[model samples]
Target chain A: MGRIKTTNNQISRREIIIEKAATLFKEKGFKAASMREIADVVGVEAASLYNHIKSKNELLNIICFDVANRYTHKMEEVEASKLTTLAKVESLLRFHIDGMVNHFEEVYVSDREWKHLDNPYLSNMQNQRRTYRKRFAAIIEEGIKKKEVKKIDAATAVLIMLHAIGGIESWHRSTRKIIGKELEENMVTFLIDGLRKI
Target chain B: MGRIKTTNNQISRREIIIEKAATLFKEKGFKAASMREIADVVGVEAASLYNHIKSKNELLNIICFDVANRYTHKMEEVEASKLTTLAKVESLLRFHIDGMVNHFEEVYVSDREWKHLDNPYLSNMQNQRRTYRKRFAAIIEEGIKKKEVKKIDAATAVLIMLHAIGGIESWHRSTRKIIGKELEENMVTFLIDGLRKI
Candidate 1:
């Protein structure tokens, strides 16, 4: 019982560090923000931070991988929907936008601190994203075959959609300038109309 | 005459550092690549590098600002064209694509290292990009009014298309299955077709 309690406490403390570091890293960047600064914010000595993680790079890697995996998992849910190919694309785009809005900090950290991960870890994260992209492309391919979507390049169509979705983190703050629901509705319609055959 | 020769040499050396640093930043990222490494590649000591620039972050700021400025300049030219709105959008997408393909390294570094720049510098770049995005939205706004584009939220339409264009740098590689020209052509078709009124 004591051992379990101790482990739980350790995990909690580590998470505290990650939360604090994530905010700083998002604001100042991974290279510019130092370990001492992170420890200072975490209310621990710089050396104590080493006890929870091997290095600053490892901490950054954990945060990035965690966020990316969350996005991948959310995308998986979209992939499982019973919608048509075009609808699935729209749903997936919304899911991506919602994810960015809800988890802006995590997504921001993942993108900015991606380089801190070691080679194998970085490659794994990259592959996960690529696989997610391929899943989108597969949906486009299905739409093309069904003649629901114009016979455009499936890869290109999917990539274009992904780009639009992925970039929401950079610009979503100003979404209120137009009614959010109205803007989203129009975006969906515009995308669908663009994909349909004339 | 001696002063003129020294000034030219300084300019030449500064160019060499920027060129080499851009390449290194692309391969290893801005954080991982250091002042010493940049200097070594330029055949100078680490201290000598400071003579050419204020700091590493300043180098990054210069490169990124130039990209934002160049992109805005291209948009200005595209705006002046007498082509149809659809054609103009296609031209804009292609122009942005050409910028990415030709200066992939520089663009990639600028985008990824944006946080390194101080607030004023970063804000300037951000506003410049916002102005550029406004140009795209204005095009869409005009198109909608002219019945060239379907009635939609002009801002969202522009945002989606711009995201699709900018995201090209993340995935465009020589080894990719699609060739550059074909990809650009398909993208143009997708954007125009997606926006056209039925």
Candidate 2:
């Protein structure tokens, strides 16, 4: 693999530390992975890491908040598309599916080990997650009102759909399992049938 | 609520410590919750807790293994039910849902914090989970053979179903945000519909 060479005089050190720490946290988990290890991974002494970040908790917040921000921003773009609620969900599912495929490690770090975040970061991430859930819920609620979907709890339906999509990162083998368009088609159809009124 | 107490001498001090520790571990998560806090919750000195369990990690092993054993054993019983594949999945879903509702603490403790388990325990639990998933996969495979279920990857189908049911612990809240039964019925219909050939 190519070494992650930080620009000597351009990019901020805090940004570098956050980027390197995200990879470490993803590999070893938030608790089991140490600040010292992250520092080493970033090509710096342990003490030097504190110059850019206050603690391990801060790094977690940065990475999680960063991902959550980007994910919701991506959703905003999707929501703007002239797509039906069903189509919006399909595109959203595809975005998440592709995102997990490309960023599988980050997904694991954020989801499985979120308990490591300190109070402020934890609360912020939780609120962001609630917002993300509400986006899909709102779409489902609209569909139900329009009689486009069967009567169902919009929140629960969205939760189930999102979890099923999120689960692909954990369960997909990539090497042994099918992939590309076929896999996407199968996942979309399965999710749609599960959510659609018909 | 009435305290879980007993007059029987068969429940040793060690068991009490483990039970209390499991409750704390589930509520606060394995890594964040402390051993000293566990001792305080159990009304014993932290040092005294060592007499019953060697380390915090060991205590986690005991709780995880215990729940994994229970979940796997119950999964086997569900697999043995004399019903069609869809009915069997419904039974499996009911078992996990009811168990989570009744033993909410134990299931929560074992599931959300599974990453804390080390070598043997982690591998053992992983195996147990794979077996649990395989039970559903087998049912899907059987359905496919009988031409009742559409052709699909048994493992993926099983994963979708598991996500649908296991996700309840995280998503369910008593508030009027969602009517729980409607959600469950939608899940059942959604899954069954997805597996039906067009």
Candidate 3:
């Protein structure tokens, strides 16, 4: 167990550990990725990996909750902003598409790998997600109330918004026929444009 | 394989084999679900399974291509019809959603499990899928030219439509807060209404 730590890094060692583990989990899936491989990738000895994080499940827990919190925070900011419903939605769509592509490792793990999390974390994670989605749906409802948006069902809109961006997962392995910025712009326009009448 | 054949069953025994395999594939996934297991549920002797079908790969190939062909044919029929572009797109939306929810096993394996297929079948399947998406996108472009649909990028619209219904996969396991008919109606409305000026 080699355990010399760097004191100069700005981010906490724990955050770096979670980040690396997110990449591993994104590549190999949560069940298939091992603590040893994560440590190896993170520049730590396998045995001393425990010194930084308690267990693999803890890392999954942190990644899942952390991503959910970030999304909720972003959603809160957009919702609380004075931007028109369309702009708020465009912001939220960009955030999701951005996470799916640019922050591929952490957000992908958060979206797809959180099922492996244990206990209260699992239930809690799902609840947090459910809450976030309902709150998102509420944003659409608010739009309809303001008469800026089409009268489409909010629940259905949220479903489209969430899963629609999931298509980008394939784009990561695709030929990159469309660059990231173009895909992001086109995708956000496709969704936000769908929200309004005329 | 059973040798004792009714000879007059409306759907062929081969169709039955494919149907059962689709169920098993949906439950256990194409990789985890075995031929022996498929035969057992299919009420055929394990050894005679190959007499009815070539291999698991053949079953996957059949399922994937069959679903894609069905979607393509539907698209062609709708495209050639005299329906308005909005109606044509709505019909296509309904077909995809109907396949996703009602034909859950075949559509899901077709959409998700095709990658397990090998060689020419793999390349062929990809080509078929790409053609379908492009044709679908062209439908949007047609609508745009007539000004019945908004001028959002057809490629992006196609992406949203295809991946949006994929969200219904999770609804299979969710509590049936929404019935299949209602969901189909609302989901179709959500996508099709997004297409045009009020």
Candidate 4:
């Protein structure tokens, strides 16, 4: 969420606060992160911090919904494309991997801290995730129908893909052997390629 | 852990307490699952639970390390076998899937609730997990060397496998479309079968 102001590509103070808070939230959990702490990191008074955001909970909402919205938006683009079922799945997988690797802070925090999200937000987040997975499963189902992919359980395939992406969190923490593009390439090859090649 | 007694194969009261504890732990978390709750579930007085086990920590230790030990022992047995690399990987995957499917309470509680374990146990548990993943990666490496598996990053392959297995928790919670052996078989076909076939 760049939220750029003008053609010069200036990010607002709000974006800066969000970025720094994502890091802090990743280090200390949502429950532990404070407005004073966020204010300190953003070089503003705790009072000033509230001018841009309402509360710690609001930061979480922004972070969580931002990541979810980005994925949903991307899924729309991928699904609408004229790409084949295999390409569609690979494109979506790359999007998830890219988010995990580069946008590590927001993506990781969003995935883990969603449990702390409030009712309407939490319920909405769950629905978004459910819808996203269903749409993903549908792509594989289409592949199976067109005889372009293996006749396997599509929902299971989606489950494997999503959780495999989640594995990148451990990948982030571990002594990583591959970085960025290579990791993305390798996973795409390992996952969706099977749906079509076999 | 069947720990079946002689002949008739009866599980002891201690075993019943452990089983009941696992379910309570899974439901209410290790912290929330008090001695009183475990006793209530087992139909014993809270005082009686202490006779069989020292504390909640022991129960967590039993659940976490028990699962760890079972996997380690199984890993040893599978490693000792003269099976081919592909077969060995398939064997391990089936072992994990079996654990996730059949032993949901113990396995689920163990995986999620290990964080509440004390220092030595936490450190030791981390080591066991690290070693297990390394060993799993080694098998994939061996498969690659033997030209039985694709030339992919072995460590990443292990990451994917383990996290994919973690996905089974969601499978347990979701409206499951497939059951035990079918889930295991589908996963095996999706995972290790690629190593040789490709």
Most DockQ-accurate candidate: 1
* Residue A94 error, candidate 3, Å: 1.8
Interface RMSD, every prediction, one decimal place: 4.0, 4.7, 4.0, 4.6
Which of the numbered candidates is closest to the native, going by highest lDDT?
A: 4
DockQ of 4: 0.26
Q: Which 10 consecutive positions of candidate 2 chain A have the poorest summed lDDT?
A: A189-198
Count clashing pairs, candidate 2.
0
Worst 10 residues of 1 chain B by lDDT: B1-10
Instruction: Please say which candidate is ahead in DockQ: 1 or 4.
Output: 1
Model 4 DockQ class: acceptable
lDDT of 1 by residue, A1-198 (tens): 111122444467777778788888877778778999998887768888877788888888888888777767877887787787777777776766665666666777786568677789888877886787777788788877877788777777767776775566545557446654665676667566762224
TM-score against truth, every candidate: 0.82, 0.85, 0.74, 0.81
Compute the DockQ of candidate 2.
0.36
TM-score of chain B of 1: 0.82
Model 1 quality (TM-score): 0.82
- The deviation in Å at residue B157 for candidate 2 is 1.8
Q: Can you write out model 4's per-residue Cα lDDT over A133-158, one digit (the tens) per residue?
A: 89988988888888887777777778
> Each predicted complex: what DockQ?
0.45, 0.36, 0.30, 0.26
Clashes in model 4: which pairs? none
What candidate 3 gets wrong by more than 4 Å, as runs, is A1-66, A79-84, A109-122, A173-176, A195-197, B1-21, B32-54, B195-198
Name every residue pair that clashes in candidate 1: A194-B194
Per-candidate Cα RMSD to the true structure, in Å, reads 5.2, 4.2, 5.0, 5.9
